[model samples]
Target chain A: MKTHTLSSHIISYVLLFCIGLFLVTFSIYYYFTRSTIQETTKENAVALANNTVNRIELVLNTEERIPEIVAKMLESSFLDRDSLIPFLKSILKNNKNICGSSISYEPNYFPDKGMFYAPYVFRQGSKIRSTMLGNENYEYAFMDWYQIPKMTQTPYWSEPYFDEGGGNMLMTTYSVPFYTYKKRERTFSGVVTIDISLEWLTKIMSTVKIFKTGYAFLISQNGTIITHPNKDYVMNQSIFTIAKENNQPGMRDIGRQMIKGGGNFASADFKSKWHPGKLWINYKGLPSSHWSIGVIYPESEMFASLHQINIILICLIVVGLFLLSLFTVKIIRKLTSPLKHFADSARLIAAGDFNVQLPEIKTQDEMKELYNSFSYMQKELAEYIVSLKDTTAAKEKIESELRIASEIQMAMIPHIFPPFPDLPQVDVFAVLKSAKEVGGDLYDFFVIDGNKFCFAIGDVSGKGVPASLFMAVTRTLVRSISDKEISPSVIVSTLNKSLSSNNESSMFVTFFLGVLDLATGELRYSNAGHNPPVVIRGNGDVIMFEKTKYIPVGLFEDFDYGELSLQLAPGDKIFLYTDGVSEAENVENKLFGEDNLMKVIGENVKASPRDLIHNMEVGLAEHVKGHTQSDDITMMTIVYNG
Target chain B: MNVLVTSSNDYTIVTIEGRIDATSSNEFEKSVMEVIEEGNTKIILDCSGLNYISSSGLRVFLIALKKMKAIKGQLKLCNLQPVIQGIFDVSGFATIFSIFPDQKSAMER
Candidate 1:
């Protein structure tokens, strides 16, 4: 059997199991039902037959009184051979099925000479003749009843036998001896005997009859079936004989008797005279002649069991019918799942979007076939969609390239830094994190010659790539020109003259520049409209280094940039920043003002350049927490270790 | 502190020379924009010549770039030195302008 999915297989298996259970239950019921009916019917037949046989035996027992009567008659009056005939004739009159009754006594017939029934009257059909009475050849001494009286020297009875001379069946005889003795010296007087008819047995059985299909049968303890309703079937016939007639060896076996309570039963399907398919049943050894009686009907008519079996079988068949219906419905749904997908595809095709594809279902069934067809349609539709996406794809690609270029611009500045690492004499740090693609803040530093450290800071007025370009050009010019040995004021004055000539945009830088002599405590510095830097002394006083502000560089030509010098101690620091730091905002849009910057410096008044820059950033953030910054932020701190 | 600047379309290119700190920052801003009145907004600073920069120098660059913005022209850089190039990489300013390997290459762009 092929395996099925869980739910459906469980249903089918449970149904089959239930059907099997019902069938077994019905079979058991059928067996017991048929067996009960068969046993009861056999028992009734045997009991009824035995009753009839016993009734006839009573009449035969009454006939038994004749011998006692004869014995009394012989004892009361002395009976010579002549008187024996009248006595026997009187006893033989009334009963019809008996043909004759007679008695015999003689020394020649007795096995022992001391036994006697002499002067005895033995009658047969109303006469006692000489040869029948006194003349005994004694060769008949070998006869069965004669030895009983001769050996016991008393009375004897023999079963009925046919007397062919009279052509009568079952004429039984009883005999008795007349005896006299003084002290154990008994004299031999011979025996008295009487005969009886056996036709009375048949007469009683004939009145109680059974139906045609039914048979009332009897068996002897010695395996004989006698008085089997059919008179011709009377003697020596038994179940064995019937089994031999049927040629079946199974009949020879004694069938197992089923005993439950009072019920003792046996049945044979080998009942037929010629075949065993028909059932024969019996109850045997009925108290009398080792006999049993039974009523045997044709096995075909034996429906006591089959009737109940049919009912249970019907219930099983009905269950099987329902199970088949459920099975078909479940299997059909599995077969049609792919059709649902096809319908979904048709809807998608109508909507003019055909990119969806069917999922894989790997079965060599009808559903898989439908999926294959849908897969083909999906491939064609997907190709059509792909062909139409050219313009959209190119636009996305350019956008991505522009994004990369914008990131490169912002990154070109020192977005994070300790701007001068090796010059411990001048601790410096700067940051130029952008708010857009670019911003105009710029800062630079390097050892121009030995301990002569040069640095500058400036800011552009606008934002984005354009402003960044200007910042780049201006930054490069400053870095290049600062290399020439000159005072800070002269270098800037030269640059101012250079820019003022073509300053059509009227844009200018508010800037500060410085050159440090590391061996001495002096910083040559200049300012061009830039914020005054915070200066921290070696002791602890913080002061603003504000030179008289000049016009921003690049505004006009021929403007002088004044320079000043401040004596620095070994631990002096200067903090420089663009407005991006002082004007920083949080998400609340609150500005981080100059007061906060001063406060931050006051708090970390003796920090190193890096720590000063970091502490100022912290203060700005604390002043304007949770607000987004509005401009590019750049700040730097430098310490002098002169 | 890295720099790369170039000149094109009638502008003479001038690149910054070194790290601009509190000491040299004001001078650095003055040197770069000195050519602005000479009609050179179409200038590219070869930031490759600049060794370092700080926030003060950033403020000067802001001031000069705005001047060019008002003048209605362009400035670009060519060839950035690596350390300053990393700053540009971090700040996302590489997207803000055109950059090239040299003066002639930037002028061609």
Candidate 2:
């Protein structure tokens, strides 16, 4: 899980939404704007075509009206040939648009003027000149202006022509027939005509403003191009020829509709020697001569404004989104600064630098509250750790003191295994173990007067320091008393009297004191309410001494103690122990009772005192495996080899 | 070991139970001495509930007996289990202390 920060998430989502919105809005705007520009360009083309047609119509209408008015004046009062020549010259002089005028009568209608008598007046530079146009080289009856008006008895406009005589120029003629009334019937007299130079019309068509790379062209009713941006097409190519050359049937169809004298606007893709790509053509028919005025604009040029606006809009949106992202990132960084500092502090705290200084936050917000909580937690943890360390130090001091006390207590007991090595008559060994740091169990043996060997093993009533002290007291009392008294009973009785008199704490000890007479192989022992010792004979017979039990010492003063004696042969051993051995418990809580103790002693009947004690300890250790010793264990073995 | 000490008139009845080994013998002694220290020196040890007694346990009873004699007070034993009576009889404890079969006789003494 790679994760983004909270502020980064916000910035990403906001930017995404903004970009999406911008795209949607821009798409709609572009579509409508493109359509609007297309429609506007189309309308502009149509308006330019219409305006060009109106100018052409005004010039053609004026030329046609002049011929008709002149025809009516000549018909009302017949003019002589000379007067007619002046009249035509004045007409050409008065109208700047008219290039020339002519009148051609029927053959032989005027006897004096021949069968084709027609006079023409035209402008050469600034001068008006007269010429006879009805000569054999110029056939008046075959001219389209003369023939059309004479046959229809109406006014007509001729196709543009380049005249080689009678005022040489490219021109279009408008003709009207004059008739005479005889006996309520009209008779055709002559054709009156006016020629308009097409140069001015070509100039007017070229002046149309249809953006750059756009042009206007004129097509006659017969589909011939009259005026065009390409000079080669003028008077040379038809609209249908250009359409076929461009391989566009749609352009041909527009040409057909245009030449039908019906106005229309259309667009088509036309590629020819003169034009390429898609073009928009708006054709309008002129009412005067049925010529169609067409305005053409390339689609690229027409939609150029739309493309420019689209690019601007896209650029603006991209820049806007970029700025938005920058602002979002800046705000997010500023807002999450506190969180970053908090995280750094948290990391330091986890690394165990609890006292690390946290960054201060002045804003009274959740971050400040969180900082305060962390600071408090840091202080509390430091205090708690300090107190815990102090408590541990105190506990360790007590434990070490107890260990020293245990050491001193162990030192007080007789730890030597072989006491009285010089006496070859007896060997003795003893071991003591405390359940706690210190214990009450004790064992001691010493030679008295070179002939009497006195040994004692005792169990004080308790454990630990108090019992240890009591054990030391009991051992001292027994040692001091035994030095003055040879009898075991006398020593214990005196020791009891000393301990019981001042026993305010009610502590006591179970003691067995024995005096061995080496010369006689006799053992005299006092048992003060203690478990009786076991004696093993040389014959492998184990005997438990069960005689003369007195109350334990340190319990009462002046209590008479009893003594028992046993005669031991050579190789006989006596085993002494506190109850810790017999009462030692195993994992099952079963005590190592006296039966087990006797069984261990009986098995090692031929063993020395050291071996006997070792065997018993091993047996007890095995029986109490995985269990704690609940009491003090003391064992002593004395072997008398007599 | 647990010692329950109850006094009736001049005599204190100390009921002992469980094992009075080296570790618990101190507690037994302290409880019995507390009764004696209160001037109830005419003590009777009821050993019917006493299952085991160690050498240290015997030392407490001996100290109690000596203290009673010094005070010129009597100490008696009653309701002793067979195992305890065997220990008393073999060690010649029966000779030193007055023993009875029941508490009534020990109290009458």
Candidate 3:
């Protein structure tokens, strides 16, 4: 029985639908945006790495070309060892990128000089200085820059090293072995070399940046880190050693790939030793120096903006959903407000105010149809109530008239307890009770010729107004025509003849008339279609009048009736009643039959007429036992005294 | 009250059953009147199933008799229960109406 508003139901469904749609749209947007941002990040990192590597390659190529030009001069014998010093000085002075140059010969190749003789010229800040780079204490012939080119008899670039005695800085040398024509064939001479300071490369790598905590680094072909943001790692560690320290097998793989002159521009397969978390790296190898340059992009910093955009998008969707719910509730409530008014009006109508005004609905919808139905029902109820009121009033009027008619009919009979108060020779009492507002039973008595007493009792065949009227007419006919000389049978026969003449309704009445001889205690009675009256003797013996050759009154004209006579003793009582007494029903539908009536009359044989009728009334009441009276009852008793 | 009517070449038989008091007299009257209105000259009211009759029911029988007499038709009754026969005897209806003990005896009339 608990109820919720339609508005709440609609709002819940709407919010659910909106949430589903938002989740689908947001998920799709998130997927494409995340992939697009990742792609752009990769492309941006690669471009930055490519730019940095190209610049480093361009500078290294120039340095390599300068050394090749000097080696060719030495090979053609165009410049002797005397011109080589000035030549190196001029080359160092012209190219600011070159920090130092040295030309080393075999230990005793000149034969005139002692064991070690190598000419070196370098720029010491703003001065052009020349000195011997190798002596008894320092062996330049055994160095990588000198020995590798001489043994390989080809040009080579050495791994970067710190030159403590000569340049006093981190530097890499490109050495080219010279050739001498001996017996018209090429013979290996000492090496011609130039050194470039790695300080500038280190400075450039330190300046390279991708984002916060993102950096660039360079590793030489031997897998030794040359220039890096962390200066300590540059000279002291290789890529493999850093990978080992960090326990990153992926870094080792990248290192192996890089030293083989292989790299990728979009692989995020490395982590910086100096930083924690995943990093995207774009690494490229320099063609001239065979050094790998890597640009590190810490993933968190690289996608920080993308994460911020996603947070903002989610917040906007949440706000949008909330606003949608609020507006939907408001709109739904506005649409359904008429139902509330209808409910109020319906309650008033149910409480008997059929004329209560209903809210008007203009829209052609279900609510409008309901309004029409309510109006129609109200009109119908009002009309029905009005007609019911009229019907009830008419019925009440008819009932009141019947009650008055019953009173009039009761007045027509002699209700005075002692009919012959002055004549101690006779006693008579009677009673009549109707089952409805009017009764069909009648009892009457009068003194005829001042010595003869005439008594009559009759029952109309039906009940209600028609039967009551018939009984009244029969009683009137008996009273008007009976006289001292008329016999009981003749009086009844004449009444029947008069009643049946024009009786179109076919109603009839049962009649009994008696003339009592007060002086002789003789009773003469006629029965016409009526229950025979009982006569109780002074000896308490009960007897009934025998059957007569007559039908009830108003049945047929010219029907002859017969009479019976009985002599009563001084204390004898003659009890007369309609069938209402003998046929009175009990709750069990058993009638108070003639036997019980005759028994009661015999028991009260010595009682007065009034006492006899009272005893019979009490016995009948006891027999009925509160059962509804189904017929009118009349009883009359005549006690003759002689 | 239930009234069943059957027509034969000689007469129409009206079988009335159950108690016919003030309430059921109208239905009894209606059934007999319908039979009389159908121009049936002879009607045999079978009282075999009639166990009780009130004054109002007696009035309906009287009306049916009067209606039949006015039309010059015959209305006979048969198979009256003893109690009902006593009522008829007291009311002197046994003298005015032709009564028979069974349907076969009434059909011979």
Candidates sorted by lDDT, descending order?
3, 2, 1
Model 1 DockQ class = incorrect
lDDT of 1 by residue, A142-219 (tens): 566666677777666554456666554645566666553435665544455666555665555456554335555544
Q: Where does candidate 1 stray beyond 4 Å?
A: A1-14, A31-53, A72-84, A108-142, A152-160, A167-195, A203-642, B1-109
Q: What is candidate 2's lDDT per residue for A1-642, written digit by digit as tens?
A: 428877779888998898888889888887888788888877777777777777877777767788888878877766655799899988888888888888878777778767677788887778888887777777788877788888877788788877766455668888889876656667887888888888898788778868777888888888898988777887788999987887778878888888898876666646645556777778888887888888877888888877887788789888988888888888878766878787888888778787788877888888789888988988997788789889989988878988998888787777875666688998888889898988888988888999888999888776778888898888888878887899998898889899989687667677899999988989998988677889888889998877555766776688898788888888888899987887789978688888899999988998878888899989998999969888899999888888
Global lDDT of each candidate: 0.62, 0.81, 0.84
Q: Order of candidates by DockQ, top first?
A: 3, 2, 1
What is the per-residue lDDT of model 3 for residues B19-106, given as tens digits with 9 covering 90 to 100? 8999999989898899999999899999999988987888888888888898998989999999899899988888888899988888
- TM-scores, all candidates, are 0.39, 0.57, 0.70
Candidate 3 docking class: medium
lDDT per residue for candidate 3 within A1-642, as digits (tens), equals 328788778878888898899899888988898789888877877788788887777788888888788778877888876777888899998998788888887687777877776888887878979987678788888888888888878788899888886556898888988777768888876888888888878877788888787888899998898988777887789999989997889889888888887868554665665666777787888877778887877788877887899899889988988898889888877777888888888888778888787887778988888888888988998898889889998988998899899889999999987766798888888989998989899999998877788889899988889888988888888888885246998898889899999988888888888888888877888888888887788887878878656789887898888888887778887788888899999998898998898788778777877888889889999999999999998998888777
**How does residue A102 of candidate 2 score in lDDT?**
84
Evaluating just chain A, the predictions reach TM-scores of 0.41, 0.63, 0.68
Model 2 chain A TM-score equals 0.63
Please state every model's RMSD to the true fold in angstroms. 19.1, 10.1, 6.9
TM-score of 2: 0.57
Q: Against the true structure, candidate 1 has what lDDT?
A: 0.62
- Where model 3 places Cα greater than 4 Å from the true spot, the runs are A1-5, A65-82, A86-95, A102-121, A141-194, A198-215, A218-303, A322-326, A348-367, A395-501, A508-554, A557-642, B1-6, B13-31, B45-58, B77-105
